[model samples]
Target: MGFLEVEDLKVHFPIKGGIFNRTVDYIKAVDGVTFSVEQGKTYGLVGESGSGKTTTGRAVIGLNDITSGKVLFEGTDITSKKSKTKNVRKDIQMIFQDPYSSLNPRKRVIDIVAEPLRNYENLSKIEERKRIQELMEMVGLSPESILKYPHEFSGGQRQRIGVARAIALKPKLIIADEPVSALDVSVQAQVLNFMQDIQKELNLTYLFISHDLGIVKHMCDDIAIMYKGRYVEQGTKEDIFNNPQHIYTKRLIAAIPDINPRNRADQFKFRQEVQKEYEHSYDDYFDSEGLAYGLQPISDTHLVALPGKG
Candidate 1:
């Protein structure tokens, strides 16, 4: 069994209406999505805005309520109230998107990193401060910075602080939701590379969620493309990048910006062709309501949403 598994996970929100605010309808944020993360590997959940990628990560970490489905960690079903033990909670943690707002501006860095330790470990004040200092140093920040506040650092540094907080408890799996999207282009690589280094050193598993295919290519072993609360395609990094089957996956891959100016014209032409094909064959992939069909296996490791056999 995989280290982390999500089975037919569905996270729907009630759309209450009228004066009484009774349940009217549901927003199917994550509809029947399923995947698993192997130990010490990165799994990417890629999609556009409002594609429910973030919601999926949140649901897995217990930040968002699961309307239905099971989230199993290390063979234990944590979605059930009785089974989600403290050890399970510590084993699973999340690094939220947007470092600018994720860290509490009011609190000092010592408190931020110590929050997890306080809950999970009974450390004395001296021991806690020493541990926070070590965590700061691990994420490339100075041990002295633990006394500072969140507003005192740059965006990249703030994210490093967030990382320190995430790994403070020595978590086995980290749900990193768009961890670098909010940083500048120049700083994005630094954070990504540092994350890779930390992952290797700590032997950590990651649920890397992002909308940037380029960044996803740099970081993930397996990938799943999400749209409208469902998966359109899923495969190894090579499979999705080199042999995309679904029209949506092809379009997304085609949209990745080619940095080399010499190939710009050719890249533009290819993207235009992909766009044309998507526009013409939209109905062939999605149903009348504009939703992807259930996934069908195209290969051993590749699955694409397609019409079922008659």
Candidate 2:
């Protein structure tokens, strides 16, 4: 079994309306998603906003309730609330998007990072201070600055503090939802590289969720392209980038900005061709409801949502 497994996970929110606020319909945020993350590897869930990438990560981390499906961590069924043991909670953690709002404005950096340690460990004041300092140093921040508030730091620095809090419990898996999307482009690389460094140092497994395919290509070992709450394609990084099968995947990849001036013309032409193909063959790729069909394996490591069966 993989280190982290989510099988057919679905998260639906009740859409209440009318006089009594009864459930008239359900908004299917995450519809039948399944994947696994191996130990010390990053699994990328890529999509635009409202495509359920964040919802999937939230469900796996227990922020959102699952409508159906199973979540197993290291072969333990932690799907239900009762089944999620204290050890299981300590094993999994999340680094949220928007560091500005994620860290409490009222709390000092020391308290922010020490919250998890306090919950999961019985350390004295000196021990907690030492551990928080070590984590601050690990994320390239000053141990002395632990007394300051979140507003005292830049955007990237706040994110580093968020990272420190995430690793405080020594989690085996981290669900990072758009970890660097809120930061400046120049600082994004620094945070990502530092994350990789710590991943190697700590042997961490990551469920990396984001809309940027460029970042996904840089960070992930396996990639799944999500659209309208379902997966359009999933494969190894090479397969998804070099051999994208789904039209939606093709469009997303083609939409990535090409920075090379020499290749701009060629890139534009390729994007135009992909767009043309997508417009003309849209019906061939999706169902009547405009959702991707269930995943079908094209190879041992590649799966795509296609129209027909073999």
Candidate 3:
């Protein structure tokens, strides 16, 4: 079985309206989204804002309710029952986007990092303190800083604190919901590289949700593109980066900043061409309701939501 598999997952929020406030319509935050993560691999979920990439990650970790479908973790259906178990919760962790808000300003660093340990394990006081210290050091924070509050640290350090907290129980999977988007460019690189290093050391699988194509290219082993709550394309990093099949994916790739002065003219021309194709062929990829079609397999590792009858 895959390390983690989400099968036809959907998260719909009901829109209440009228005096009676009866069922009006649903906002399909995640519609039929399906993907899997292997042990020690990073899967990138990339899209523009409001594309439901963040919602997908939240649903995987049980933060958002699943309207339908299954989430399997190591062959067990976590969506239905296993998600409630202490072991399952311990195995799956999340690092939220906003470090400042995610970490409680009222609590000291030790309390924030040790919160997971207290929930899942029955470690002695000394052992818990030792564990939190080790986690701090692992994320490049000094052990002595454990007494400091969240606001005392820099933005990057606070984020690392979040990272330390996420990995406290040595989780098998970590849902990183735009983990670096809140940081500066240089800090983003530092955090991303630190995450990569820890993934190697701890054999952690990551569901990386982000809109930055450059960061996705740097960190992800596989990539999936989402639009309007539906998956448009999914494949290996090489496939998506080198030979993107979906128009949305192509546009995203073309938008990645190219620093080479020599390729300035070529890059601009390529983006213009992609934009033209996207504008002209938009209807070819989406239906009248502006939703993508169901994904169809093009290769063993590649799937695309091409418009037409299956």
Whole-model lDDT values for every prediction: 0.94, 0.94, 0.92
Model 2 vs truth, CA RMSD: 1.1
In the predicted model 3, the residue pairs found to clash are none
Clashing pairs in 1: none
TM values, all candidates: 0.97, 0.98, 0.97
> Residue 43 of candidate 2: its Cα lDDT?
95
Per-residue lDDT, model 2, residue 78, is 81
Candidate 3 regions exceeding 4 Å error are 81-84
Q: Residue 105 in candidate 1 has what lDDT? A: 90
lDDT of 3 at 8: 92
* 1-310: candidate 3 lDDT, tens digit per residue: 8989999999999999989999799999999998888999999999999999999998888888899999999987778544356578789999999998999999999999999999889999999999999999999999999999999999899999999999999999999999999999899989999999999999999999999998898899999999999999999999898889989889988998898999999999999999999999999989899999888888999989997664
Q: Once model 1 is optimally superposed onto the true structure by TM-score, how far is the C-alpha of residue 65 displaced, in angstroms?
A: 0.9
Clashing pairs in 2: none
